[model samples]
Target: MTLRVLGIDFGTTYSSMATLDPVSGRATVLRNAEGEEKTPSLVYFGADGTLVGTPAQNIMLEDEEEAAWVFMAPKRYLGDGDFVRALPDGRVVTAVDAVAAILTKLREDAEALHFGGPVGPVVLTCPASFGPSARDALREAAARAGLGDVRLVEEPVAAGHAGLRDQGQRLGNVVLVYDLGGGTFDAAVLRRVEDGYRVVVAPRGLDRCGGEDFDRSVYRWFDGAAREEHGRSFDASDGSFNSPVLRACRMAKEALSSKPKVTLRGVLAGQRHKQDLDQATLEGLIDERIAATVRLSKDLADAADRRGHAIEHVLLIGGSSRIPLVTRQIVEALTEPRGLPEPLRLGATDFAVAMGAVYALVALDDMAPSAGSPWRVRAPGTVFRDVDAPWCPEMVVLPRGRFQMGSPEDEPGRSNDEGPRHWVEIGYDLAIGTCAVSFAEWDAYAPRGSERYHPFDHGWGRDDRPVINVSYEDVQHYLDWVNDRLGLTGREDRYRLPSEAEWEYACRGGRETPFWWGGSITRRQANYSGDYTNAVKWLGEYFKRTVAVRNFVPNPFGLYQTHGNVLEWCEDTWHKDYIGVLTDGSALVKKSSPIRILRGGSWNDDSRNLRSASRNWFPSATRLSWIGFRVARTLIS
Candidate 1:
C-alpha cells in the first residue's frame, strides 16, 4: 500500500496545496471548487452564518464591518492572545480556527482528486522565523482538520527542495535564503555538508512588513488628498474610510496599475467629491514606503555581516519581487564597481515556495521511506533530521545556465522594463527561498522588549495578516537577534543587499517582457486594481490601498505580485547616472548618506511606475506600509 503525502503552502495572502501521486510520480497542484490552484486566504460569515471565499471577499467590500467575514490575511495570530471577534454578535474565533477552515477545504480537494486512497500523512510549510508557539498552532490546526499525522517544514526549505529537484541542481556549501511575503520578511543562512543541510544561523524576520502596507499607504495618501480637496475629513475614525465612496477610491487605486488613470467618485457627508488619480500622484504618495524597504534590506545585510558570516549570494523570493523599483534598488545596492558577474540568478518569485515544497517532499521521502515502498527514490542513502535551531525555510540553488530571459519582442504590450530587448548571460549560480515568509517566522525573531513585539494590533486587524508600522531600524534589530542566537558573525560583505541587476534578472525568470505574464498588466494577472475597472464611471475613478499578495498571477519564473504589491528595497546608493558603473551586478552603498534605493511599484502606483526600469529613492531611516523586501545570497562553490 502506497502512502500519499500532501504539502500545503498556507500563505498570508493566498493558500495552495500539492501532493505526490504515489502511482504517477508526478506532483500536482490541487484546485479548489472554484477550479483554481490557489485560494484566497479569506473567510466570511454570512447573515446565515456560512463561510465563503471569492464571494465573501466581495461582500466585505460593501459591509466591511458587518460582513462578519474577513478577506485576504488572517493567519498571523495562531498561538497569541489575538482572536477574531464578530461585533454585535461578539462571536470570537481563534486564528487557528480560521486557518483550519482553509485547511479543511484543501483536504477536501485532495480527497476528491485522489486516484488511489485518501490523502495520508501531510507536510505543511512555515516561515523560517516561526517560534515554538506558532509551530504548535499549525500542528493544532492540522489536527483540527482531521489529519492523522502532521509534519512541519520551513517554507524556504521546501521551496529549495523543489527548485533543486526541478532544475537538477544541488548546493555544495553555506547559502543564504531571503524570503519576502505579503506580510513579513525572513532570512536564513544554511550550509550543505556530507550529513545533509544544516542551518548554521538562526533565521531572522520582521513582523509588521509586507505588500499590504503599500496598499494602505496609497489609500491613506489619496484619502488625505480627497479630504483636503473636499474640505471633509476622510479618516477611518470618521467612517469616511468605511464609506462606499472611500471603498470606491480604493477600487480605483487597484485599477490604475493596468490603466493610464482611474477616477474616484463618491459623496462625502452629502457632498460630492470626484478626483482623477494620475500615476505620478500615486507613485509620489507611496515613495516614502519604497525607500524604507530598501533601508530594511541594507540593515538586514549589515546585521548578518555583524555576526561574521559573509553571505555568498542574495536570494530573491515573493510576489512583490516583480516591481521595477525592487529590481533597480537591488542592482544599485549589490552590483560591483564596474562589473564582474551578476549575482546568482534565482528562478521566478511565486513558484519558488510551491516548487520548493514539492522538492522537499521528494527529498524527505527519498531519505525515509515507509516499508515495502516500490519507488526508486534518488539519494536513498540520505538521512532525515529536523532543523534544530528554529527552522524557517530553505533556499534553493539556482544553477547558472542559458535560459530564455524575456518574451519575444513581437509580444504586444510589453513594457520597457521587460527589455530594450536583449539576451544576457548569468554565469554564476545562487540560492533562493522556496516560498514567501510567514507570520510565524516574524514572531520568532521579534524583539523581546521592543514596542513592536506585540502579537496583535488593536488599531489594525489581526496578527496573522502581517505585522506593519515597523521602521528600517526595527528590521535590522531583528536580524541582529538572529545572528546573536546563532553564534555567527554576520559579515557585511557576506550578508548584504542584492544589486538591481540581480533582482530583475531573478524576476524575469529568463523572460524579458513588460509584465511577468509577457503582456499588459491585468487584474487577473496580478493583485492590482481590476475589480474597480467595471464599477467606476471612468477608468480613473477607483480608490487606492494595498490588497493581499498572491492576489495575482505568477511571472514565468513563478514569482508573484512583482509588478504591483509593495515596493522592495535594494542595496545601492542612489545615483541617477549609471554610465561609468560596473555592470557585473553588485550593490553600492554610500557611507555618508543614509539613503537607499526602493524598487517595485505598489497597489497604488500607475502603469509607468510599474515599469521594470522605473527608479525611486528613500532615506534609510524611514519606514512605511507600501514597502518591503526579499533577500539573496552569493553562490559559494
Candidate 2:
C-alpha cells in the first residue's frame, strides 16, 4: 500500500523503472539481473522459452542465424505504419507486444526489489515527437505488461522534472532537452515553473538518426580500414548488423566516450582483424550525423522563440548523449565564442526520465484532490500536535489551491505595496510550521547572543515562545543547520523560508476575504495590539506580548497566530509592487535585494496591519523584537 505509483523510462536501447511511496515520500529505482538500474531494451525467443534484458543482450554473442528469433530496438518500429514482426512460433506480434514483454520482465524485476502485490498507477515516458498513434501504441504496450492504466509523459518534460531543483534551476527560465538515444534524436523546449515545468514548444525528432545510425557509421569505417589494411571486409549479409563485428564497434563507441582511442577486434567475412580507432577517426565517421542533429536542435530553439520562448540551457540526456562530441556540439550551439554557461551534462541522464516521470505523477496527483485526499487534509476534528523531532518545529500540512495574493485597491487601510491584486496558483502541497520558530529550536542551532546584534531570549519563556530579535542572516544559518541535521537535500524536500506569495497563500488558506476565517480578524484569534478589531461587534482579548504557539484556535489550514505574534521573513526580496510577478506560487528572488520582504503583523502592529495582504520590508540583517521567522517544506523528494 505504501507504493502508490511506478514510473518507467522505456527507451529504445535501455529502460529503467522506479517506484514512489506516497506515505513515506521516498522513491526506489529497480535494478536488473546485471545489478544495474538500466536494462537492455531487448527481447529474444529461443527454442526453450523467451528471454529479456541481460540474458537476451548477453546472448547476442551467439550466432544470431542459429538463435533465429530475436527482437532488438523494437521501439524503432512503433508508429511506422502497418508494421508487425513475426514471432518464432509462426504467429506474428506487433511492436507493442514485443515492448510489453520487456516491460513485463521489468515489473517482475521490481517485484523482487522488496516490494510485493500488484504495482499501482504507472507512468511511461515516450519521445516527445511521438504522435497520438504512437502514444496509443505505447499505452497498449503498457497494458500488455500488466500496467493497464498507464499514462504517457514526454521525454524532455520528464528529464527536466528529474532535475528541476538542481540543473533546471541553474538553467534559467527556458530550458531544452537534447536527447540522443539508440533509435532517434529529440530536441524539445520547456519553460521551468515552481512545481514542475510546462512545454513551450513540442519536441522535434530525427526519424532516421540515433545511436544505432552512428554505430553503423563507425562499423562501416572500420570495415573499410580492414579491407584496405588486410584485404578483408565484414559480412554484408542478413545477420551482419548483429554480428560480433558490429558488437565490437558498439563497445568501442561506449569506451571511446571516456578514452581518446579504442581497439576493436572481431571476425569479419571469414577474416579476423583488429583496428585501433582514435577519437579523430570516430569523429570523422559520425560528424555528419552529429552535425544534422545540431542543426535540428538550433532550428528547434528558433522555433521556440516564435512561440514566445527563449531557451536558456540545453540538457543532454540518453546514453548516447554521453559522447564528448555530442556534449561539445550542444555547448557550442547554446553558447559559443562569448562566455556563457555551458550546456548541462547531467550525471543522472540515464535515469532522469524514470525519476522525472515519478515526479510528474506525484505533481499531477496534487492538482486533482480526491474527496478523502489523505495527502492534504486531516480528520475534521484533528488539531495541532507536536512534530516527532525535538530539533524541528511543529508543522501543519498546508492545503493546495489558488487565491488572490495581493489586496484590492478598495480594501480598507491597505498599503500601496499590497495593491494590484494578482491571482496566484499553488500546484503542490506544502508543510509550514504552526508558528514562528521557537527559541528552543533556534538555540539548538546557535546559542543566544552569538549574532552580530548579540540578541538574547531574555528567558521570556524559551520553550514554545517565538524566537524574536533574529536577523534574516541568522535565520538562514539556522535553516541550513537544521536541514543538514534532518538529512534533507536536493531540490524537493528541504526546510527553507516561505516566499511572500506562499506565506500569503497559506495565510489565506483558500479564503478570498482579508483574513483566513473571513473578511475580518480579531485580537482574540491572534496576538496583537488591542485598541481596534477588524471584525465588527466582536469583543477581542488583548495579548500585549508573545504567547506560546498554538495557544489559540488554528485557521482552516491548521496554522496558528498567522495574523500576528511576530512578523515572519519570506524567501523573496523586497519589491515596490506586485507588477509582473511570477504567477506560479514561487518566491521572486531573481534580483537580490539588500532588504527582504516580511509578512504578518507583530505584537505592536495595528489590527489593519494583520490583514493577509499586508507586507513590509527592512534590512536583511536587522534584528528586531517583533521580527521572527517560520519555515516551509518543499516536499519534492
Candidate 3:
C-alpha cells in the first residue's frame, strides 16, 4: 500500500489534521486526544513535565501563573526570540521547537491511528501572508518532528481547493483566499493552473488583528467599565492583572456569537466583578478590525488585477470565519470592488485549510512520479510530459537511435537537399512537442495585443493552432523565457530547436521512408495541401491554410503534423546538402549565412514538398505564415 498523506494545518492558534487517501480521493479530519476536530496550539513546560494541546490548555485554566510558562500561539514568534521559553532543565525552546513538538505529537497520534503506516507524507499549511523566512521556519519545524516528507502550501490556496474541488472545472481561474485566524490575517489571490494553484498576487496580511484581538477588544471594554465602577484604574504594567480578564473575555467572545448577551466575571484584588457583554456592543468594538481585514483583501485583489491577475472567486477560511460579521464584510468587500462573481462560501471553514493541504498532496502526486523529479510527468499512451513548465506544449519522448538522414537518389519526389542518404546518430533522447507550439502557449508568455510583443497572429484560429508569423529571433526570445522558467534545476540549457539530424530522426519516427506511414500522403493523414499526391493517385483535400494541430494522424513516435502543417525551424544554419554535416547528429552552424534550416513541409507546400526528406531554409529574421517551430527538450540524464 502507498503511504498515506496527512495534511497538517499548523495554524497560529489552533492546529488540525486531515488524512488523505490520495488514490481514493477521500479526506477525513482526524481528532486530537480530546476527541475534538481542533487542538489549541499551546505547549506547556513546568515542574510536572511537558504537555500540549488540551492538557496544556487545561493547566492554563487552573491558574493564571501556571499558564505563564505555557507557550500559546507560537506561530507569531517564529521569526523572533523574544518569546523563547526556558525549561526547568535550562534547555531553551524557540517558537520553532514549540511548533515541532506539537507536530511530533500530532504525528504520533496520526500514526497510532495508522494513517496507513508508521510514516506518511505531510503537507503543512501556512498563512499566505507569511514571507520567505517565516515560511522557511515552518519547514524547519516540520523537519524537527521526524515526520515523512513535508510539503508546504498557503492556507488560502488550500482553502480554495477545499471549496472548489467539487466544481470540476472552472470558468475563470483566479481565486482569492480570505483567511482571518486567531492570531493572523491573510488575503491572497491564487490562480488555478494545470496541476495546482500559483500565487499570482502576494498576500497582504497583519501579524496581528485576529480573533485574539477581538477578545482583547472585549476585555478592554470590560476593564474600563469595571475601573469606572470601582472609581480607580487597573495597573497596565502588571501582566497578571490582565491575564484573568483576557481568559474570561475569550470565552465571553465565543459565547456572544451565539447569545445576545453574556455576563463575564473576574476577580480584582479579592473582589468579584461581573460585566454584562452584549453581542451588539461586541460587534461594535471589533467592527473596525473586521473592516480592516476586509480592506486588506480588496487591496491585495486590486494589486493582483493591476498585475494582470484577476480574482474570479473568493474562498473564506479560518476559525474566525465562524463570526457572521467577518464573513459578511468579506463578501461585500470582495464582490463589489471589481464586480467579480460572488465568492464561494467554504463548507466546514475550520477544516478547509487542512483538507486543502491534502488536495495539494494529491496534485503533487499527479505531477511528480518520484520525490526528486517533480517537473516531469510519466503517463501511459504518450511520451514523457513536462507538467511543471507553464504554457508547456504536449511532447513525446524519442529515444536515441541511428537513423538514415535524407533520401536515396532514386526515390520519388526527392529534392537535391535530400540526396546522399547518410547515417546520423542521435545520442540523447528528445522530448519533441506533439504539435507546433500554439498561439495560446506563445501568448501566455507574450500576448499579441501589446505593441512591444508582436508578431501578432493573422486572425487565424488562435487556440491549439500553431502560432505563425514568428521569426527565428522571436523563437529565440520564447526559448529564453522557457529556459528562465526552468530555473536553477539545471534544466535551463536543455531546450533548443532540434538539430537538423535530430529533427529528421524524430520526423521519421523509426521508419525509413518518404513519410512515416509509407510513401503516400493523403488529406486524412495531415493538414497540408494534398491535391498533388502523384505518388498515390487520389485527389486529396486542400485546407487552403493551417488547421488545428493534431486533426490528423500522429507519427509512430506519437508526434502529430510531422509531414505537414507548418514547416519547423531547426538549429542548424543553411546547408545545401548532407556532404559536410556532422555524423553525430549535431547542428551545423555557419556564420556566413543569415538563414537557418526549415524542415517538415508546411500546409501550403505541394505534396512533393511534403515528403519527410524535403528541406528548405529562410533568413533568420524572416516571418512567414507557413513557418512555426516546435520545441525539443534535451532529456536530463
Candidate 4:
C-alpha cells in the first residue's frame, strides 16, 4: 500500500482533517462520522463514557443544563498546567485530556471512512504564537490519542503553501497571510523559496480577537435593543434560553458574512426577541477588532519592506476572513500603499490550513519528484542514445533552474514583446537534442514516400546537414515515428518539441548576456548572416546557407548551433505579450488558432534575430528552407 499521511487542523472552536490522494496528488478534506467537513472541538463527560465532536456540541446546545459537563475551547488553556475541571462524580479532566478526546474521535472517523487501515503519518497545524510549553502540551495530547510523532506546522505558513500549490499561484512570490480563526487573529509575511516558503516576518496575533468576539458584540446589540423596547433588563445567563440565544447570535454573525441581512430570533427570559441585523451594523460592531488585525498586517508588510522584499499578494484564510469588511478594509489598506494587488480569497477559506498542512507534509516527505525536488536520472550535459535505433538524435540533459524568459528593454536587439521580462522555473528532468535534427536522423524515420514524407533539403546534401523545410504540423508525424522506435508511444515519458520557455532557458545556458558566449557574437560563434550586427566588435564572414548541425562550438549546456541554426519549432501558440502566462515552464497552448512559436535565428537571417530572447512565429503549415526543430524527452512520467 502507498504511504498515506493525515493533516489535522486542530482549531480552537472547530477542527478539520485532510489527506493527499496518492493518485491525483490533491489534498482532500475528510468527512467525519457526521458527514461534515468541520467537527466541533467540544467534548463532554457523560454518564457511561466520553462523547466528542458534533454529538457533544449538540448536547451542550440542546440541553443547556449540561453546559457544566461540556468543555469549550480547551486549546486556549493548553499550557496552563493548573487548569482542570472536576465532574459531578469527583473525576477531573485536564486540558490535555479534552484535546486528546477530540483528536481520538477525529482519527477514528477518518481511518474508518478514508484510510483503509491506519494512517502512516500525521501533521498538525498550530498557531505561530505557541511557545515551548504549548507545543509540548499539544504533542502530549497527540501521543495520548495514539498518534506517533506528529509534526507541527504554523497555521500562517501552512496557508501560504496552499496558496502556492493548491491555488496554482507563482512559485517565487512574496505574500502576506491573514488568518482570523474563531479565537485568534494572526498575520505573517512569507517569501517563496525553491524548497518552501521562508518566514520574512514572524507571525503576530491577538489572542482574544476572532469570530467569538464578534458573536459577543452581536449578542450585546440585541440585548441593548431588548432593554430599550421592554423597559426591563432581560437576563438569559441563568435560564434555559442562554445556550439557544448564543447559538442564534453566532449563526446570525456567520450568515451576515455572505448575506445583506439576517433575522435573529430566539426566546429570552420567556419572551421572544426577533431582530434583523444588516451587514453594516455588524461591521460597525466589529470595526475596532478588524482594524486592529489590519494594523498588524501593515506592520508585517513594513518590516518586509525594510528588508527590501516587496509583498506581491495578500492571502486570506480562516473562517472569520470571509467577512466582506475584512476583505475590503485589507485591500484598501494594503493595495495602494504598497502598490500590491487586491487580496486573494480563492475557494473556501475554512479548510486552507488543513489542506496546506498536507501539501507541506508531501513536500517534506519527498513522496514524488516535483518542482522542489526534480528527478535526476543522469548528470547534467550527459548525452544519451536510444536503444536499437538506426540513427537517433543524441539528447543532452540540462540542469533545472529559473531564468528570465524575455529580453530587457536596454538590450541591443530588444522588441516590444520582450519588454516585460519575467522569470520561468524549469524543475523537471529535460533532455534536449545536442543539435538540430539532422537529415541523417530524419531519413531514418521517413526514408522515401513513407506516407506523405517528402524530403526537402534545399539542394543541400542529406548526409549530415540540418534538416529544413519542415512545418510544425509535419513535426507531429516525426514525433510519432521516434516514439515508436524508442517504445514510448503513449507514455508520459515521451519525446516532443520543447516549450517556448524551456527553449529560451536552455539557450541562455545560465548567462544573462545577449548570446550564450558573451555580450556580442561573430561569424566564429554561430552561422547567422553578419550583414546585420548588434553590439558586435568584429564583423566576420557570413555563411549564406545552412551548415552541418554541429558546425560551431556547443553552448555551455553542451548544445551546438542553438544560436544560428534553422529556426527551431516550439510547442506554444502565439501570444501578443506575457500578460497572463504561467511561470512553471509549461507551454501556453491556446486552441483558437495554429500560429505557433519559433526560436533561434537561421543561417539566412541577420545577427539581431539570433539574440537569446528574440521571438518569431508562423502558421503551423508554413514550411521554409530555414525552418526545422529539435526534440526534447521527458525523463520521468
Instruction: List lDDT for all candidates, in order.
Output: 0.54, 0.73, 0.74, 0.80
**Which ranges in model 4 have alpha carbons more than 4 Å from their true place?**
170-172, 228-241, 365-637
Once superposed on the true structure, which residue ranges of model 1 sit more than 4 Å away at CA? 21-26, 62-65, 114-117, 167-175, 190-200, 233-313, 335-348, 365-637
In order of TM-score, best first, we have 3, 4, 2, 1
The C-alpha stretches of model 2 lying farther than 4 A from their native spots are 1-3, 21-27, 87-89, 228-233, 236-239, 337-339, 364-637
Estimate the TM-score of every prediction: 0.52, 0.56, 0.57, 0.56
Q: Write the per-residue lDDT of candidate 1 for residues 1-637, one digit (tens) a residue.
A: 2567777888877777777755666556777777877777777744566464555666776564644445246667765745554534556667787778778877877788653456765778777556555766887888888875566666655654553344333332534555666666555554453544444344556554555555566567666777788776655452434535444655665575567688776565777767788766766765555555555555544533543445454556666544445545555764342232233335545656665565455554333446553322112112111123332323333334443433344554333333443344455544433222223455666634756553333243322223333444554565565434432236431323456666666565555555555545554444334433112223333325544444444443434456665566777767654444444555656678677776666655655455455556778766665665554555431
Model 1 lDDT, residue 266, Cα: 59
TM-score of 1: 0.52
**lDDT at position 330, candidate 4:** 90
Over 1-637, each residue of candidate 4 has an lDDT whose tens digit, in order, gives: 2556788999988999999887788889999999999999889998787999888888887877777788888988887789998776788999999999999988898889988677766778888666445767898999999887477777877787787776556523788889999888877766666665555555666776888778878887887788787754344455323666767889999988779999988665677878899999999999999999998889778856755567888889999998899988897898667677778875968998999888766653332333444324433544444431336666777877999889888888777887589989888878888789988888887887677577687677887788889999889999998876555788776889999999999899999988998778888778887546563535566767888887776777877788986899999999888879989999999999789999999888788899989899999999899999999877762
Instruction: Give the candidates in order of lDDT, highest first.
Output: 4, 3, 2, 1
For residue 198, give model 3's deviation from the true position in Å.
4.3
Candidate 2: the clashing residue pairs are 492-636
Sum up the clashes in candidate 1.
119
